[model samples]
Target: MKTEKPISEGIMDSLQMKTSFKDFNSLKNEADTLYLKFQRMGFIESELLELKKENDSSYLADFSLGKKFSFLKVFYSSEDFTKKELQQISSEVDETYFILSFESIPLSLKKLTAIRNQKGNAFARVKLTDFEKDENENLSATLFIDNGNVRTVDSIVVKGYEKFPRSFLKYYAGVRKGKIFNQKKLVAQNENLNGLGFVSAVKPPEALFRKDSTTVYFYLEKQNNNLFDGILGFANDEETQKLTFNGYLNLELNNNLNYGEQLLINYKADGKEQVNFRTKLTLPYLFSTPFGLSGELKIFKRDSTFITTEQQIRATYQIDPRSTVYVGYKGYESSNLLDEAIAGTPIDDFKSQFFIAGGSYIKPQNRKLFPVKNAILLDVGIGSRKKDGKSEGQLGVETTLNNIFNLNYRNSIFIQNQTSVLFSESYLVNELFRFGGINSIRGFNENSIDASLFSLINTEYRYQFNDGIYVHSIIDLGYFENETISIKQNLYSFGFGLGLNTKAGLFKFNVANGNAQDSDFSFSNTKIHISISSKF
Candidate 1:
């Protein structure tokens, strides 16, 4: 009696012999007759082997006294029964006591004893799940579309890839199944094909199939752009002296294309005996468009009989991208005879025409120490005078407000109004109401003064530096309304300046001192101004 069985009682006796052989309803008609005489043999259940007779009609079903048998030999045992009736004869009806059979195997090796060698045999062995199912059954590929397009994969055979990577299956095979397959625009044309700085990312390798069209390959990387600059400087104190220079170069195209188109040129020199020449085409994003269309065009020349032609056009209707409602048109023509004696009329064919078909309503607010102080601009116009027909039929209004503190500097307050209507019967110019220079009373000059109820109280201080230097200071008080009667005529002025801005031109060096005395002090006391690139 050698005992040792507790692998959970041999797995509960192999689940009680497979539930007693499926309760053998007679083995379902003997399972095709015991599967053809045990086709590959089975039933290897051995135990009780204590036999002794070679007699008694041939009895010898024993091998010492092992005692563990259950019964096998369906019919070839031949032991007449003596071994004490072969242990009471119940070895499952030992037809003749033959035992030891085997062929049935598989509950994953019932207690697996050991015996391997079958997959194409010769000592067979090779399988980590068949090398991961031959690398998940590799498919084969090649594809690209950086726009120049390419996709061709004729004969790419695949059953299973041996460890992947034949250049990553020829990059997911884009096309080659007879060529010409968009494969869905090869990853968005390789992410918009870019260069110099770098950029790219697009993926879709395989599995968008008609049959199996796999192709993908894109790997790229670089991206940077935004550079800017500006400069200006001008000098003058007369006595045949001077300095002028302005510069700028920038490129930040398509920042939403924010209305940009620039290329301007300007020139000046007192040392070179010449002082003006300009060309321009600029679109500073039309102030901010949504319904705004701004415009500018210019051509200028100097010393060669002074030449200048300028134009400006504008339109606005934001209504709320930050408030706005505007309409504008401006014109200025010159043949420089000192810009038509400072645009006071000899325009040597220098048509001095002014326009302002106006409409304005604005509320611009942006503050961080007065980024735009605050705005409220309202204007109107209707005046024409060519070679002096003085065909005036003009009515105007202007209002400005400001508040700013430090960092360079800023301060401003202004008010205005002008009315006129005289198509000539020359009552020595009977209808005229006006202000001063630089677009109105900046220390007096243009139109000096005329009465019919004019009023102005101005104060300004401005400064800037770094690319386009600037400086401004002004103080003036004006009043008028004595058309041969009623008293109220007062005037005063004081000005200071220095400015030079470039992307092709803008220069001013001024000094003024006025108390009116018939005005026109040839630029108050001293002046020098140049606005090239035709005042874009």
Candidate 2:
């Protein structure tokens, strides 16, 4: 017989052939599946193939595929892309895809395969090497794709916020190093920074990718917080039947000496020879905690009406961005100087000490000017008045709403109602609520109506033009009741005005008509109101 090939050698050859075929088939099947998937996705010119030698243990695959142009075509021209369009597309694509590796092609492909197997077809990677335009000027890119791992944040860098502590910024970022970078969280942090009132502008966080890590950078622009402002205007006092010149001056130092502290000195004078002065200091953070401290001293003196002075110290704790609770101690002293005719009775001086507690909820609009959107304030206090040696309690609530329509036309609606009640053995002129004037029942004299219980509502509709100027119409209703004094009155007023807002303050001119009874309405009793007040 012819020398037969050894049986063992034949068996070895058969096993090698089977293993090689299996490896080649595995790679070919995977490539073919990807190719067909891309073709169905409208990548008409795509191909995938494997090369393997009969005796080699490894195989090499070369893939040539067309990049999906549908998304690009929707936003860009086929020949080229505008800068903004390109940036938008790049951002969208980066958010959608994660690149696992840019070096070592085999490892990348292997990792991609594992990811694809685990994630079912939701993952993809496209590496473009060249671009070619077809007869229709449609662009196509050579692509190599595989599943990839998402990039994690390596570090965060903050720039252009020199006044703010780095720790503060990091705390607001609300992220740790080496965590998966999230675009939504970054956007939230940016918005939070903008709302702090210290920053004028904030750029979107930028991600710099390196290998598998992403470095995020935050850019900020700070606003000027140190200012000195003044306001000048005129007012009419119906009680005195005299016209008065009114003016205010304010000095502010904010975020300079302390991180976010503010110091304010304000002085106001009116033509009635009345003067009011106040000094206040605010510390936004107390000992690095979320609590705040504020101290104020106020002095008010009118020639023949009253002389009042108050010292207050308060501590506030922030519950969140929109809420706060505060407690304070107030020492007040007042001397009533009204004549018997004006007061309707003889009144004595009073001294009081009080403990006050309150809370506020403010929903701020996201705008540079006129930031208040909605707010509520409630305060309750219990005290002892030394003049009468009696216990006294007071409650006050105020609410405001603005921008009701949420329209870009700059239309706004505002409503404010305040009620103050006192519990005491006997009512004193200083303790009674006074209603009238521009701040209360417009078209009436300041402090013209005084009673033990008083309530008032002010409603306004405002329309803004250009250059921070606005026109507004207002309605005011007020009621006063005093069973002990047997005095009851209802007052109503309607007015229209124009105002100009400046960085320093707001200046307004108003004309109003008031009537104590429904039948007493006439333009002959019109009142003129003028005022200017500092913003800070």
Q: State model 2's lDDT.
A: 0.63
State model 1's lDDT. 0.38
Indicate the worst ten consecutive residues by lDDT in candidate 2.
72-81
Residue 327 in model 1: lDDT: 63
lDDT, residue 100, model 1:
27
TM-score of each: 0.20, 0.60
Query: How does candidate 1 fare on TM-score?
Result: 0.20
Give the least accurate 10-residue stretch of model 1, judged by summed lDDT.
Answer: 111-120
The segments of candidate 1 whose C-alpha lies over 4 angstroms from its true place after superposition are: 1-238, 246-292, 297-301, 304-309, 314-332, 338-347, 352-536
User: Could you give candidate 1's per-residue lDDT for residues 1-536 as a string of tens digits?
Assistant: 11133224643343232212343354343333333322223221223333334543433322122122222232222221233333332234334432222232222122111111111111222111111112544211111111222334334333222222122122222222454434344333332232111122223323222243433344432222222333345555355565444332223322122222344443333322233344444343243333545565654444444555667666655443224455666554654445224422222443434455444333222222122433455555554535454453334444443334444334333333333322322211122343566555555554445555566665556656544666767666666654434346667677777667664444556565657546565543543322322122
- In order, candidate lDDTs are 0.38, 0.63
Cα TM-score of candidate 2: 0.60
